[model samples]
Target: MKEDYLDIKTPEYVAIQFQIAGLGSRAAAFIIDQALLMLVNILSIVVLYFVMVGMEPLPVFLSHSSFPVAIVIIGLFIINWGYFFFFEFFSGGRTLGKKIVGIRVIQENGHSITLLASFIRNLIRLIDSLPTAYFLGIIMIFFHPKHKRLGDLVAGTIVVHERKAKKKKLTPIEKEINLRGLSQNNLLLDEWTLKSFTSKDWKLVSTYANRFTQLPLKERNQLTKQIADILLPKTGLDSAGKTERELEDMILIIYLILKDEWEFEL
Candidate 1:
């Protein structure tokens, strides 16, 4: 049987998988945190009740006063919110839930999410949790291809698994040399370059291949040049030729590079 492997070349596709992993982790963390918080709150309330009872015989009217109960509720809310905010916003986007689940929230562009974004996302959780049981958020997850909740979509953020370290058979020197070569090419595409492809580009390439073929040679060449320029900053393409086909081949090479599966035919 052939060995199966996860492909990492398609950033969009990989992002989806990361979303799933992250959601699972976050859910688990939430349950644990809630459980712990509940236990602590219960214990504290019990202790407080005993202390209050020991101080004096409670009047019936005072016993029904909502002030103490309100304080406890507010305190619990603050503790839970504070813990979530600190970890999700400050600790590299991972809370105890995220850390155990091996996922973190990040910006849509694959950058670290800002404090503002984090705050907005968390604040919006109230809406996402509406109508009891977070049903809206759950529905969004099922319906959205990226499994984004209202907060994630509104804040232009995503949850992703941190890339795991893979053991490579290649020696350090060889790896360095390969990296250098990849960095030297002016026409080669890189991971970021390929991932930057717009939906229009994908549509044209996939659904309108015939129309693309009908474009003028100069136009096609120009398009290739633009793509090459975007990728050139990060890749080292052999500058021996400048043909359109050569440009396409270079893009393919970059796809392979991003996948870390390049094999030279020659």
Candidate 2:
């Protein structure tokens, strides 16, 4: 069967694929979020009503002051903006709605979403909501090939269906790869060691992994040399015995180790 997927070539040469979430799923997620927001608003209104009633006996100056008004406005703003920002940032890009719908947001390059991007996207969400009921957002999602609304386009993010595997067991090849990545020589390499490589570095490794077989020998050799040169010393991998021709193999192993350590999420 044919399926639509977005293939992202990371700088590491790995070609990652994601199935994009369409208009209907996105709309459903948005509806759920809105319903949640309405619930919060109702609760806030009830609390504020009590507060106002309690303040009725206070000095007229305090009762008529703008402090209560200002507090109410701030509360609304936080409820609207904080809800999205905190959820997406802390939940690995899955808001309550998106999680329920089995979808999530990620960077255009397929990296996990960052807090800043989450803030920017949700900030622009105000514009997307203009002219009543997300009419503009709906139009953009309908026309854009990837189903991105204005906020997503502005923030360099896309919504994708979470890929869930039914089986928990690893295949023979998978077990072998995992064992290879966890060999005695790679024991020192942990999350801290992985942090030495930047996001760009990982992307390059990813690109190489996914595109390795397809790359021309000459280009592949060049990439292998370039990436190996940067990673060799930082990773503390000894290359004294290896030749230039073997550097590609070393880099490929490094990529595998890093991939196993940092399996991309969200």
Candidate 3:
């Protein structure tokens, strides 16, 4: 099949693209999920059987009056449906199967799947799995342009491969800091003194340091001085008699140090 893409725009009109997942990948993911569900269901049935009947013979289990078979049916129903609903609802639209397959369910508008949407989709999965397997669902997916089964079409969701995260290019401040070597030794920040700066302080510095490049020249200087004034005292440094450029360098320096402590590379 030709590679199909979904193009969407955010509220800000930033366009994004996603590749639609096709039958092969979706089927693989479903098989994985079904395998896991089968395991859980078997375990649950065994536990319930023992709990209801004890170690007693089949007569206890077979005794219609003593056996609550409806409970077993209900438990199995919940597990079969709940597995998909709970995982899709809470796991950002990816079950373990979908996550491993690198695909996720999302709304047609490209947002995360909503709770109601997840419920409706998985509820319709009963119909999708008609005639022993997902025969109808498979046919629908193979024929649908977006590869949506009835569940997805009904729920206004699509399965799409996750977009690989683009590496963030260095901000202007980062480039300048790299050029000037904004390291701990050069900045002379005492280890103990730096640790005193809290997450809130990091937010103050990071906001300005990372976003300074995007502001207009005059506004950038004003915000830099404002952020510098708030942060300097925490680091046992003052912005006294410093140029806005120098103040910006100091903020970027703090940013570099604190980011190391707080942020992990992804």
Candidate 4:
């Protein structure tokens, strides 16, 4: 069964869901990558220190070899750069840890990004990580509405939650409620008829409801009756059959018209 009453309209709702998924996956991957890189750097430094100390016993060897140090630095740069390229280019925006955690990065409009887009985004991280004391990436995350980093912006991508499976069940009586007749076009809702609503659309309806209530009681009742008349034919219900409670029920029915299940009842 589907919970058709739930609606997500604002960007904040989307952003929050994205963040929850990212923290569990993308963020974990990043932390592991950084830890591994730091370990490699430390190990390189230790090996260089021992090599230099051993060379002190031989002046000729010490005087001739800054090349090894330069080579090690170059190797480190190549290793780090290649690591980023390998993951971003071939793995569909996931590193080993991200894959384990179940999240994939995709374009803002929801498409697979190209290798060049990924490269440009990560390469520019050098500038974003600047000032020798602070990370500009964190600042960018805080300032951007979508919490995107420079890489995300350049790649035109956003991290999103992988869709999870939903459990559904139905009752025997609910199976007999035919819902083929329900569709958005068939439901007629007007300002006054939705006055007592308390769902997501309630805010929208409440504005008009308040306005209608400001009029004289007789005028308000006449307006409500007029709205009911307009809705009756569209809903395929008789005038005598419909009641005030059906007004709110109609809103619920209209909202769920597109859902897979036909179990909704008043």
The digit string of per-residue lDDT tens for model 2 on 16-73 reads 7899998888899989998999999989989987877887586665565686778788
Query: For model 4, how does the per-residue alpha-carbon lDDT over 1-266 read when each residue is reduced to its tens digit?
Result: 21111123354445212332332344566677777777978897888778778775656545656866786889888767667667766888766556666766666655565777777777876766676422676666556656567877877766555556666664321231223343445565564544433343333333324454256756755555555554444545565656554543453354344232222421
Off by over 4 Å in 4: 1-28, 42-64, 100-102, 132-134, 167-266
Off by over 4 Å in 2: 1-3, 59-62, 65-67, 166-266
Q: Give lDDT tens digits, candidate 3, residues 16-84.
A: 999999999999999999899999989988887677567465555466753567777888899889988
- Could you tell me which 10 consecutive residues in candidate 1 have the lowest summed lDDT? 1-10
In order, the Cα lDDT scores of the candidates are 0.63, 0.81, 0.87, 0.56
By the lDDT metric, which is better: model 1 or model 3? 3
Where is model 1 more than 4 Å wrong at Cα? Answer: 1-25, 54-64, 170-266
- Model 1, position 233, has a per-residue lDDT of 46
Q: Candidate 4, clashing residue pairs?
A: none
User: What's the lDDT for candidate 4?
Assistant: 0.56
Candidate 4 residue 59 C-alpha distance from true site, Å:
15
Give the local distance difference test score of model 1: 0.63
Kindly give the stretch of ten consecutive residues in candidate 3 with the minimal lDDT sum: 58-67
Report the C-alpha lDDT of model 1 over 1-266, residue by residue, as the tens digit.
22122223345554422334434555776677677777878887898788777867676655766967886788877776777677878888887767776778877766678888888888888888888877887787656666678999998887766778768797443453355453325345556666665444444333223344456878867766776665544445543457776665565345434434322321
- Name the candidate, 2 or 4, with the larger lDDT value: 2
